[model samples]
Target: MTTTSPLRSEDRGNASVTRLSPFQPLTDEQQRLVDSIVRFCERHSHDGHAALVMEGDAGTGKSLVLNTAFQRIQSEARDRDSTRSLHGMRNILLVNHPEMIKLYRNIAATIPTLRKKDYERPTSFINAMHKSEQRVDIVFIDEAHLLLTRTDPYNHFRQSNQLEEILKLARIVVLVFDPRQTLKFKGYWDDAHLRTLLAGIPTETISLTEQFRVEANPDVMTWIRALCDGHLLPLPAKQHFDFRIYDDAARMYDDICQRNDACGQSRILATYDFPYTLNGEDHFVQTGSFHLRWDRNQPTHPLPWAERPESIDEVGSVYTVQGFDLNYAGVILGPSMSYDKVTDRVVFHPDRYEDRAAFSGGGRITDTPRAQCQVMANALFVILTRARQGLYIKAVDPALNERLMLLWKERG
Candidate 1:
């Protein structure tokens, strides 16, 4: 007997509800940004090449703005009578993250005007366009910071820089980038390099500053910023937001499960200090008595790691949780981090880090101890910013745990 697969709508609706919907309404700021991007694309559609960059931290809805603008561009490109006057122009959207690419493809299935083929990974898009000897009218890139600056033969990308290759194949390019969320040496990016790339071209930048994800006061935001900046400051009083420092990892998992039950989209996350691999083996993140496997590789699975029901029992990493929003996140600061009593700051030990793939083939980017520290700190920064309503944390280092617990107590 043979079985048939479900319709795309039925499959997506039953499996996952993503945050990257093209139909989601935009705020006034988002709307203005979209209008500006559309205008830029219109001016460049017939001739000339230019770039527009949207800069913001996590949870500022960068993806939302990009998706909305892409939909408008697609509509105008397909409709000759449309007032925007972008008719029969080719366009596509690219994202470096596999999980985010899956989410965007699932979202495209639901929208009538959007096609799954319209979305792709940057590497694949570059190679395919090269083979066809074709140039697109417009290209949209989400999480541009994750684009590879150096070639990786393992990933089948032979080009030196992804952004440069993309610029040569598209008339207009729009990117959403946050340098602080950059996690790997291969994808290292900063303001200087990006500006140098756009030096000769007509470029426009939009900076989004409002915090739209974490439902917290300014003090709480400041505390998180300070912690990621390597400072061990006093915890702030958080009345509206649920912030907690747990003495035990097991206790934090229990509470995260409760949050997942009470409300959907809550999970536990960790830095790259744990042992994990992609060789089809189950590697667990162990802290105290709390042991859960890291997120598995599900190539055939349509749903993202966080959207899967079984993933509640798994611990997410920076790769799985980046560009995703959770109701509550329980973060375990693993062995790579320690509290320095002499300097009164949080220090990162690169030798203790276990994510070997991140540092593999790294050059000047990971040469200095300070640079290695920043890479790990950025991983923690991504983990810390995933929570939308609440944040819970547990540190594996005893001194770090004690410092955080004492700060929590003093905040009360």
Candidate 2:
């Protein structure tokens, strides 16, 4: 639907959303930022080659802010239009956004797509928009952190397939991303040239600092900061965060079941880095056990069980659990195996280290975890914030926890 309209809300009086948020209202700061950016968009009024890079910590209302702004833009456009022509002018083309797997994948070179969900077709939805004369006034990239440079080692497809052309089109491109979530791949912000190229266009940056995720747990924030910066916080353990590092995940799972079962809701996230034949795509990664339940007295975990659903019962990874939350969350960090900090680079956690010697024959593929710690820390911070009431973290690797503690110690 190419309709320009503001997000309708019944509770404008509410300051910040808190109670089991399905729809989170923007914070005052976020709203102000959106107003300024939207004002700029209204003022500049360009038809081609313009963009806004929206980056922030997760839970800081990046998506909410953009959605609110887009709605406001629609309202403003409508207010100005006596002929309802501005609605057509305000046509927005959201490019290559990440969301529910089915809806996104179905939007292909041909719509109403058919195939197994494991399709590898559209990367940057921008290129498709650019080719169409459909008049997209603004282009918003939801997970812009997933944006890859023309030089990343994807190895499967052509580089010129996406991003560039769309950047060349559109009145304004709003990029909402957090590079911390980019543990598995390289994104648009990773490369300097791409940044420079995007910067070459008229751009302004708006950063969100107030975090709405991970409530009442400052330690989670501290650990995140320490991980991101080598202990660059006032106090890493400012408050108490219950996310613990357990030696045994199964035991933790049992404990979680027992405790949460009493309240009749227990969810488990079995982060098993295992080799499985689920349609035969090797998921080669380390896994662990994570459990979160409403109460702590349940006898056992439930089914539909492994993956999270909007029903608020079972739990899974970012894939299923995203857009939903719980009273208490326990994210089991399998291993601090994704990064290192000693050599000032992004290296895979030694535990999850895949031998790339046969391919690169060197350390080019694996960077020093230290180098990537800043990004990783940011990511961990975002993940930690996902909890509303309490957070329980259980890292399998003691050394990783120690490193985290060290980061806290250094923060002093």
For all candidates in order, the CA lDDT equals: 0.84, 0.46
Tens-place lDDT per residue, model 2, 146-244, is 445444335332454245655655667776656665443333245454476677677777888886656655556665555445342333354543454
- What is the per-residue lDDT of model 1 for residues 126-216, given as tens digits with 9 covering 90 to 100? 9999999999989999999999999888888999999999999998999998888878888988888899888898898997777778888
Provide the TM-score for each candidate, comma-separated: 0.94, 0.64
Question: Each candidate: how many clashes?
Answer: 0, 36
What's the TM for model 1?
Answer: 0.94
**Relative to the unseen true structure, what is the C-alpha lDDT of residue 105 in candidate 1, on a scale of 0 to 100?**
89
Task: State in Å the error of residue 380, model 1.
Answer: 0.7
lDDT of 2: 0.46
